[model samples]
Target: MFNIDLFPQALKSDENGQTRSCLLQQTTMGESVTEQELWFAYPMNLPMPEDDDCDSYLLATLLPAMQLRAAIRVHGSVSHELLANLTELQYVWSKWLPERYFLIDIQVDRIRDQDLQVESAIAAFSGGVDAQFTAYRHATGRAGYATRDIKAGVFVHGFDIPLDDTEGFNSAVEIATQVLSDINVDLLPVKTNVRALWSIDWEEYHAAAIASVLCGLKRYAGIGLIGSGDSYDVLLTPWGSHPITDPLLSCGNFRIIHDGAGFRRSEKLIILSSWSIGIRNLRVCWAGNKHDKNCGHCEKCVRTRLNLLLAGVDNPACFDTPIDSSLFRFMVLKSDAVRIDWSLIRQEIIETGRGLEWLPYIEKVLKRKSSPKLSGLFPFGSKRRMWVKKMLMRNK
Candidate 1:
């Protein structure tokens, strides 16, 4: 059995005058695994309910790893409805990735729906295209919500940046603060070692991780907006963050909204291009270093640069250097998401009668195999090899 204990909330202030409210945890699984005093810290300056509610915090922190162990004992209050939704959501998630399927036993007190209180609206802001688009639309009243009602933007250090990297964490805070400030929104930073505590597939469990962070702030934020990674039109199965799974994460007073599903990657850029802050402070590099904002050579950075160029708003403010089309010659488009984005960029080039300049790179990408097939690993007959090649070409 896996036991999780949520200790009473504690308030602490740093030397810099910033205050943090923390919900600390202690987890143990027999003699194999033991995590003591793990914490989820939230900025305390933001508005919060009169009563301390640790239900949302427990759900967010323990749900992802519950299945890995046989049973979970959460010593905190949780919503009965939210618990049911999470149970069902886990079923759907396991179906998509059978390798991760495992039975989970849950034990916790349930909070009645009538006792829930209202909370302010907030979105996860990472200074990326998807997050920026969500913040811009919701904060500008373009999404039909009052601009001022959306209270603040939440940034998590352990999600993208490692928990131990103080330099990266500080840089992300600096960037997120500048971006949110330009839009007249407060920045709420949360620090946690949740990812380090739980050993799960990052791609498959990131949605749960993100939702947990938002839920941890449920006392302050009622509606948590999670930016969509892929648009609804081309949404593939087995994705961590989807329109279906995100909304189910809501319980009692806190609701998780999967924002920006209606817009494509290209369309989102067009919307963000109108905002100077979005253009000037966009950070999309997965290969970014602690010293540099964007490495300018990674697959993600190259893709974003191409999309910005195709959108007609490519500038030094957004990227340190111009789009190096030659980089495409070396990049192998692996995932469906990257391929889809490249396809859209390809169509844009063709429509603008600029295909000749990019034809070589596009053809190279099309000729490359789709993810490696089993046949590539073992010696196979010509017939099987030929079939795999055709499938790869057809996918392109």
Candidate 2:
């Protein structure tokens, strides 16, 4: 059996900021690896609470435990509500992806009760389309009663921007800070090494990692808003973050809400088009270049440009160069979900009678066939095969 031991360490103050860490020791199949640390660092002025619980560590390590079929035993306090919610969360995951993931056992020494105090919410902000939509609606009271009072927008350094990319992270943070500040929300920069700890699939592990970060910052906010990538009409199953599973990550006083799934990417962009601050400062590229925030050549950058153009914005300030219509010829959408996004863009262009010049390129993207290997593997159609196709498309 796999064993996971959680040991909370004292807060360390360094030149960068205050770091709260937990030492994770994993042992499996008669082999062990120690010295792995899961930590979150905040600015000097942001003081973290003294809550000595392993909830964050448990959430962060859940995917690894399931992969190893490990029974997790925490040496520190964990919330009873979180443990109970995890049962349902695992049920959803195992049900969706039976081949890759299954339910695992979890245990803890002390179970803490919920905090009765109420506090404002915090959102995971990457300066992307979804995140900006969520932040803008709530800040402008467009969400009405369902709106959350977001105290701060959390910009995680290690998620999109790598831990070693200190300069890139700081630069991106500056842009995110400015955009959030325009909506009257403060920016909280956080750093973590959870992704480096394991070789798990990032598509399945990212939400858990984000939840762990939010849980660790429960001292500052009670509610966490994870922006949704797809709307209800085009929901993608077996995804890391979804409207169904995001709420299950909540524990006791901390709540996770998946926001902005009601509108499509193009629809959301249309609304955000009016928000000048968000439009100018959007940073959605994952090209790994330190200097360029949005490389117009990448698939994501090209997609965002198309979305912006459909929304009636041309040559957005966030992108240095305009998207080339011919770029669609070489682009292969990695997933059916992304293909659907492009299809929706095409439909929007047709319906609005705008951006008609780019329809042929969008059609080229839509007409492209699936990988030959995938077609060969799933020649005999079945429910299981269809699900497998969807899952494989994500990784392809």
Candidate 3:
């Protein structure tokens, strides 16, 4: 068993005082490190300032915190070695951290149950098709009691930022707000930077945050929600053995995480369109250059553009650069699609079986593109996965 003392100081540093992302795991020398641990640490009461604004807590604290939990759990066995050196660890964290936060988010409800006068319910506000559908349901009161009464949010802290100056998230927030407003559910946006400690796993990451929410609810029951939509169906972790584990279940991240059962990307665009989400207010680029316009060449920009095109909505401000046709081909083959395929580009992982992690997602989207059997289809796409998978298997 290998354990990294993430809290301990590193042995050396580069020109900058910045501690490399690697944690030193002091085991009896010569023991091959197996299991990995990593988590992001933030100051306590980080979300207190915006307790009333659920969106702030969810975006700033919950989303980032939960993603750190997912990273420790999902990629533990696969990237355990990524934690070997400080500079190496930082490099891996640079990519892995953002992937973890891809669609992480949360929602809250303070309601009166038969047994208790007041209880707190927490759900993820995944910016995907499934989450969009759930938000719609909460709006019209399809099931029981009209409208979801949620008020908080979360994210993998700085995970929202891009590795390089690539793009922005204006559109994402605009879509999110439009969804919340329709359902009368207040969306809280929180930013999290919990992946700083890469030695701890997802369980502990959520334990701290979930624990914080539980504390926030005080006497009320703490609820962690898993929601619906098409993106949920496409993701392997959304349904199976995700890294989040019990922490995802403590209040339960499983309950709300549905598999492609609700909304599609097209419908979401239509809904947002109805709300008049202008191109400038929406952001989907994640290149790290906040001021720079979207790098249409990146996988993310292309995907967003394709989704919008399929939806029949036109707005150029969201992404200024016209995506190169070659860039689209590269993205189709996993160029810069994060969370879904970003892991494939990792220098080390690319040499392995999962050539580009997004191959599978691309495969899913391809099957749905321009298909006669498809219903309510707009457009989100992918491919080149079989060849990559075959190559990855051959190396072994």
Candidate 4:
């Protein structure tokens, strides 16, 4: 059983004299792990959900991780509607990963009208391709929504960056602030140790974790836009954030919008290429640190650089170094989605008749050559299989 304890909001002033309210959650599970506390400090002047409204907040925030441990052992109570939503989410999880699924038993009391006041829409901003595209579209009213209604961008520290890496968090804040400021949107930096508290897969638990943050701000936002990592055609299974699961995370007050399912990563890059903000501040490095712009050598960095080149927006200023063709010799293309993206990028290069110098290298990278197996009739049997998969991808 897991328990959630909501502490009263505490207003405290930082060294800079800026005041902020600290929203706290203490979660205790039976036997498996020790009690963990999560703190979210928001600007004190901003209107937020009151202590009475914490039931829904806890439901969204604590339930996913708690369900993984034991049944939800609520310290106080939860709403029936949220319980139902969570139960459904658990079902979805079970379908996604049957090995990880378990029945969710809740300690709750039925409550009515637990929804907070509806207000503006906000998108998760991470200075990445998907997030930047979402922010750009929504902020410019291109998403078929009111531009001004989409207000601020939310950046959480613990999701992408390590919780203890204060320097990295500060760096991310700087980039996110600059990116959102260009679109005339406010940037809300949320600090949490939720990842540290629970032993959950980042890919599986991310959507729920992000939904929790947005739900906590129910008094402030009505629609929470989560940037989609995959396109509709190639939605990756076992992914935490998806078009299907993201919308289901919505409750009476908050609606989690999975933005940018229509556009592929390359397409999103093309859209962002025209935007000066994206050109200058686009960050897509998995191996980046507080000190570097982008390592420019990691798989993600290399791919982004290639995409930018294909989009005609490749700039040396945005990346620490030029695309090293040598990296492709050993760089492994692990997932089908990644391989697909690379194939699209290769096609773009061919169609445009540009970047022909890199074609041989790209082909070499895409052609997966596996090692020989002892039981195989043919030498390089796995390599033959890999060749078949590569041919299928090319034909498709």
- As for lDDT, the candidate ahead, 2 or 3, is 2
lDDT of 2 by residue, 83-159 (tens): 98898988888898888677888878888886543588999888999999999999888887889999988888777
Q: Residue 154 of model 1: what lDDT?
A: 82
Query: How large an RMSD does model 1 have?
Result: 8.2
Over 111-152, each residue of candidate 1 has an lDDT whose tens digit, in order, gives 555546465688987788898888888888777643335778
Q: What total of clashing residue pairs does each candidate reach?
A: 0, 0, 67, 0
Top lDDT hit: 2
Prediction RMSDs, each to the true structure: 8.2, 6.7, 15.4, 8.8
lDDT for each residue of candidate 4 in 1-396, tens digit (9 for 90 to 100): 454444434444464322222243434444344444455555545666544444434544443544455555444334455556777777777787877766556554434456554778888877888889998988877777444377888887766676656787787788778878888888988766665555555567788878877776666778899888888987788688988777777777777888889887878878888788676777776444442256666678788888778777755467755676776877677666577777877988999876777888888888985343322332221355345535644553
Pairs of residues at least 3 apart in sequence or in different chains that clash in candidate 2: none
Alpha carbon deviation, residue 113, candidate 3 (Å): 18
Model 3 scores a C-alpha lDDT of 0.35
Which lDDT values do the candidates have, in the order given?
0.68, 0.81, 0.35, 0.67
Give candidate 4 regions above 4 Å deviation: 1-33, 55-69, 77-81, 114-116, 145-148, 334-337, 347-354, 369-396
For candidate 4, the 10 contiguous residues with the lowest summed lDDT are 373-382
What is the lDDT, from 0 to 100, of the residue 357 in candidate 1? 69
Clashing pairs in 1: none
Q: What TM-score does model 3 achieve against the real structure?
A: 0.44
**By the TM-score metric, which is better: model 2 or model 3?**
2
